[model samples]
Target chain A: MIELFNVSVQENKRLILNQVSLRINKGEFVYLIGKTGAGKTTLLRLIYLDLYPSQGNIIVENYSSATIKRRQIPYLRRKVGVVFQDFKLLPDRNVYENVAFALRVIGASRREIKSRVLSVLTQVGLNHKRYHLPHTLSGGEKQRVAIARALVNEPFILLADEPTGNLDPEASRDILELLEDINRSGTAVCMATHNYELIKLIPHRTILLDNGEIRREFSPAEVQQLKVIE
Target chain B: MSVFFLLKEGIVGLKRARLAAVITIVSICLSLSLFGSFTLVGYNLQDVFNRFYKKIRLEVFLDSSLGLDQLEKLKKKIHQNPEVEAVEYISSQAALQEFQKTFGQDLSSVLKSNPLPASFRVVLRPKYTAPERIEDLANRIRRLPGVQEVLYQKEIVRFLHKYLGLGIAILLIFAFLILVVITILIFNTIRLTIHSRMNIIEIMQLVGATNLFIKSPYIIEGMLQGLLGSLLAVGILALFVSFIRDVFYHGIQVPPHLYPFLLILGTLLGLLGSYISVNKYLKY
Candidate 1:
């Protein structure tokens, strides 16, 4: 569960998120849709405690974002998985190591980490590529590896920013389906994307933003209507 | 999470960047070797001079015009001073005989008569051997009746004292400079090794790796570098020391006690260099 109230983010005297209030409950799948410079990444960063909110409060699993100590940031991050747009895998490491990286950071036992990493790799249908290096994997496969890394810790919620922005349609569809399956398994996921087609395909709750303001909260039907019009 | 895993990671990292690690180790050893050599030389010089100072004695030549009674009284006055440890009166004939024994073959044929002066060989306590203290004692002896010039080679003592002080000062400066140079070189080497893995660092950070978790391997690597470098340096120094003792034993006199001290110094330098290098680069 994540909540943001009257949250505003600023960088270099420019407002990125202007007094935004948003909330997502546990086990819910939500889409954060916005154009470039619409404060989508900034919002995700706030929930992830990467950047402090300029004005307002954010609660991620009961920890206050505005007041959390810098040292506690890692602990908070351990509870929430973040899938970056770019698959930030260590080039020198294999897929299994990359996924196991998250578990290692949290002090997971080697045996537990191996089993968990293998299970997540299997879940993402990349079990065969476990030992393959990041450079050897395709964009889809790399993203899958990133997804596996994010989910390896079995975090309560997953925050993805433009998870499918760089993939082809088929790869994008695979990533979306993987996220949908993850969501169905009862982990809350708040994914930011401009991929309206994928949003239509999945038909999740959609939060729309324009110029730093939440323009509308659209039902699955309204989102379908918007897609049809587009 | 386990220290074993952290150490394994550190060792693996070192193995992966073998060239950099070797460079770091070599730099540390070179710096420490220079430092250790300077320290050993300075320490031994101090030791040799201290021994020489402890053995130095003052000679008070008695006036030939004085009577036996006056000589006895003067000797009693000199022996009563707390600074005088032992004083042995030598007659003029006895002094000449001792001189003949020392340079008998070379100068015995050239001399017409015994020219050595009658003197008291005065050995003072160790604490009174300092130039100022010896000078004070010499002045006291010079004022005694029936006593001629009091000789102690004041210039030699002064020169040795000043030279030893300067050596120590220069050794300290050299040690400081070597420490700075070694730290910077090791820091740069470790930084390069870490830079190659910046992506891994970022990913680790993203995955919620604590700062300690990220830094532990580098610290361990630094410690290992220090230990290995020190061991190598001590080994090299030991060889050099043995060679000097074997081939140039008469040229330079190093006291036996300095060997263990040099090894400890080398080990400390290695540990300090590694700690400094690792701490500098391990920070965000």
Candidate 2:
């Protein structure tokens, strides 16, 4: 579970998020919708403690942003998975190595790492492409590798910022569906996207942001209607 | 567990930064070798000084009128003293022979009769090996009957000690400066290597890698370079020492502890450099 208590984020003496408060319960699938500079990235960064709130507190699992030392940030991150828009995989390593890297950092044994990495890659349907490099893969395949890396640790929550931002529509849909399947299997997924078509195709609890404020929250049908108008 | 992964990554990082790593290793090696050579020189200089000091003696030339009985009495009196280690009686005939042996001609062949004086070559105890101490013993011996004059080479010892002390001081200062400069060079080299893969480090942190996990590879790379550089220096120095022994038939003895000390020094230097860089440039 994730909760933000009147969180305000300021960067360079400018307010980025103003008195923002939100909560997502366990095993929930949520969508964060915002334009280019609507503090979407800032909100995601707050969850992972990449950027701490200026005037409020966040609780990810049991850790608090206000009291968390720099040393505890890594432990906090291990409990949550993050997916970037660009599918930030280590370029030099292969798909398997890229996926295993996450597990390796947590002191996983080679045998444990091998089995878990293989299992996660299979879940993402990229077990067959385990040896392929990132540059050699299609947009969809790269996103799958990225997802496999995120899921390898079995995190309490998956935070994806523009997971399909760089992909074609078909690849984007595949990634979204993979995310949907993952959410169904009991891991909370928070996907931040600007794709209106995605909301219509598979509506979920959607939260919209404007000018660093959480403007409104819409149910699946209302968000679907908003997507239809788009 | 993660140790295998860390080691693999460390080796991989070294390969990735091979050019910079090799250059750093060479810098460390060259500086350390110079240090090792100076240490060896200092050790041998001490060795030579100790050997020469042990042989210091006061030479008491006897008067030409003194009888063999008086000379025997003087020799017995000198040998009885606690400070006297040994007293060798060189008769005037034996002194002439020694002179002929040194100059390759009999003194009797050049002059009507040998003018060389018979002397007692008296070696002193270890505590009296100093020039001033020998000078005190020389004055004592000069007052004895049948003794004409007392002589010992005191200036040579003083000159050698004073200059050798200054030389060692200068060497130590030079070594300190080189070590500091080498440490800085290694720190910069390691910083560049880490900067090259900073994104990867950031991603590792993102994926829950601890600070130790992120730092391990860089630290290991630095130590590996250090170890390799130290080995290369030792190999080169060993060959040079062997060459000296073979070509000139004069062995330059290296202190036994120096070889191992070099390895430890090199490794510590590498660790120090990495630590400094990590402190300046790396964070969780």
Candidate 3:
């Protein structure tokens, strides 16, 4: 769960998020919709403690920005999974090693790493392509590998920043379904995307961000009429 | 947390940046070998200066009228001085023989009798062989009983006192500059290596890898490269030392401790360079 109260983020005298207050309960899948520079990425970064709020604090799980020490950021990060549009995978490593990297960095044992990596790869439907490198995989498969890596540690929440940006329509739909499947299994997901059509495909609770502020909140029924205030 | 994992990562890092690692190691090897060679030269140069200092002799000439008893007493008094390491008495007859051997001419052919005076050749302790100290001892000896004159190589001592100090100062400054240059070169090389792998490091950071977890492998790679390069340097220096001993001077000795010293220095340099680079990158 994540809670941000009166949070404002400013960098170089430019406000990215201003006085934004929101709360995400456990096991909820929330879609954060905004145009480019609408502060969607900044909000996610604040939740992960990658960027600090200029005016207020953020609480992600048990770690609070007001009290978290520098040494404790890694522990906070381990609990919050983040995926990017670029699907930042090591180019030289295969899909299996890429997924196992998450466990290896935290000093997981060989047996635990193997089991968890295989399970996650199987969950993401990429187990058959475990030995393939990132460049050889399609966009959807690459994002699946990234998701497997993010989920290897069994994080409490997953933050997806434009996860389907590079994929085609069918592939994007597949990735969205996979994310929904992950959410139903109990990990809270806060996904940021600009494509309003994806929300119509499988409607969920959506939040609209405009000009560094939350413009509106829409229920699953309201998702059909959702429109970006461009 | 596993030491083996860290070691394997370090090896993998080196393999991943094969050309960069090789360039770094070769640069370190060449620079360290040059440094080692310079140190050996400085050591041997000091030895040569020491030999030259030992050759400085203070001669105390005696009056011709002095008898055997007076000469013996004078010899005992001069030898008792703390600065004096040895005193050899050259009789007038021995002086005449020495003069004849040097010029290949008998004293009888040049004069009616031996013109050379009996003297005590005084060898000073190594610590007391400075030009000013030698001159002071000469002045004191000149005031002694039955001592007519005292003589030493004034010009040679003066040259050593002035030029030798200047030479050593220049050498020390040069050595310090070389040390700074080598450190910068190695530091930049390691920085470039880290720069090339910035994406990997960024991925590691994003995946919740602790700073220690990210930095350990790069640091180990640096240390391994340093140790390897310095070992090659030490081997090169050993060969150079042996060649100098055989072809030039047998007295040129490689101190038993220098091998380990160079190895430790090189390793420390690598550690320091890599640690700074990683820490700076991680700060972002």
Candidate 4:
């Protein structure tokens, strides 16, 4: 669903990602494990077309970084949902409005917005607190709301950048389970996190990045061995 | 996106920043009202000047020894000029009679003989009433045979002519300044609103909203501000007009379409200001 051809991103003469190549197949749930400043977020940003590659091209679904028009970025974004560590919900809006906003921007009909927002909220187990404002929600509830917002448009892929960074251990496990459920339901998910411990909890495939370069790929059993080493 | 959704978002934006919206609207209202008042003053002042110009006439005095046939020929010649609207002959006896009537004294009784010269009162066409044009015509008339002198209110005409142009120029400068100030105020207000909602804009972009989708609400907000501000300005101008009529002159003439023109101008200015600001912010 997502492929990068030796992509490189730079900022003010500093290389953020250098000659990085990877492919994420359909319905794959992959964990990007790296330390701070390891180019995990930069990789996800390239996939969403938020920042162009400095040296190479990326193909996400049908959009290409080399030939995509500036105007087409929004349409590309609609097909790929992203969640941030901060949740990025509009503080003044309630849970339902925050999720419905995603559909509204796509000019979804009023009836369709309500229906899809409710359905996604139900999936994320946030339907009961739909009217509660962001400030009133707990950290885990907030991330769930963000997930519902990302899923409201039924995107083909989900990119998460440290989505559970602010959550407690229990909450992080719940979010991980939710992501797994989403991946099993046939939407690819690429989650970038520095938490090696979480990878061992329920691992499918893990790519270890170090200093802007991919070091190794680990399967479920290898992730267990790494957990044993730690 | 639906027009209704865009409009709702606009109203929601205004509601979100009530104080800023009110300040912008008031700024537009006061500036437009001032401009409208100046426009009305210029309009009425032109009317007064036109009425005054219609009454001005050139007095072409003839030599006292000119014969009756020569006087008639001179009158015909002067009347044939394209600039001359009409020419009325006034003999010395008639001139004396008019002087006596105006001064309320018998001028012939005091002079022992009719000393006034016969003259033709020449009324020029409206377009030829400028001070310089009148001077040119007078110079032409002075070269005619049997012509003694051509008299006009030269000093008064020159004063009004020079000052009227300066007055209009000053008025135009002030109107332009007000327009600029209002535009900047609207622009900055919209800019501030966009700055406060920068996060929302980013989120909208991430959620696949087009540039037009993000900008439509701000544009609509600006237009609404303009419409309301202009309506207030028109109301204030109406009150000013009535006040002037009641306290100063009852014959003040206002253009029938002044209010509508001001309303449309205010609305368009708002639109322009908001459009530029949003486009700059979006870089679209």
Return the top candidate by lDDT.
Answer: 3
Kindly list the per-residue Cα lDDT of model 1 for residues A1-230, writing each as its tens digit. 78899999889999889989988999999998978878888888888787898899999986897678777878888888999789888877899988987887778998999899899999999999999999998999999999999999888899999999899999999999999999999899999999898899988889888778898898877788654222
* Tens digit of per-residue lDDT, candidate 4, span B1-284: 78888899999988987888888789889989988888888787777777777788999999999998998898888888888999999998899989988999987667788888988999878777678888988998999999999999998788877887678778778877887887888788778777878888889988889989999998999899889899999999999899989999998878789999989988998788888888887742
Sorted on DockQ, best first, the list reads: 4, 1, 3, 2
Q: Which is superior by lDDT, 1 or 3?
A: 3
Q: Which residues of candidate 1, in runs, are more than 4 Å off?
A: A209-216, A224-230, B51-55, B64-88, B105-116, B124-133, B249-284
| Residue range A1-230, candidate 4, lDDT tens digits | 89999989999999999899999999899999888788999999899888899998899888899999989988998989999999999998999999999988889999999999999999999999999999999999999999999988788899999999999999999999999889889999999987778877889788888778988899878887664221
Candidate 2 or 3, higher DockQ?
3
- The sequence of per-residue lDDT tens digits that candidate 1 reaches over residues B1-284 is 67887888889878887988898778767877776777667766776777777778889998778788887888889999888888888988888778778867534467776666688988877666567878988999999877779988788878877887678788778877876776667667667666777776677777788878877777777778766776777778778888987887644554465546544554454445444544454323
Q: Which candidate number has the best DockQ?
A: 4
What is candidate 4's CA lDDT for residue B230? 96
Q: What is the lDDT of candidate 2?
A: 0.85
The sequence of per-residue lDDT tens digits that candidate 3 reaches over residues B176-255 is 77778889988999999999999888878877889899999999999988888899899999999899889988999675
Per residue, candidate 3 scores C-alpha lDDT tens digits across A13-50 of 99999899999999999999988999999999999888
lDDT of 1 at A50: 77
Q: Write model 2 residue lDDT over B1-284, tens digit each, in one string.
A: 36777788888888887888888889888978887887777777666776677777778999999887888899998887777999998988999888888989877877997899989999877655555666777788888988899887789768756776578777777777877877777788778877777778878888998888888887888888888888888877788778877886374788897889888888888877776776565555
Across all candidates, what is each one's fraction of true contacts kept?
Answer: 0.76, 0.84, 0.51, 0.76
Query: For model 2 chain B, where is the 10-residue window of minimal lDDT?
Result: B275-284
Which residue pairs does candidate 2 place in steric collision? none
Query: TM-score for every candidate vs. truth?
Result: 0.85, 0.82, 0.95, 0.91
Alpha-carbon interface RMSD for all candidates, in angstroms: 1.6, 1.4, 1.4, 1.2
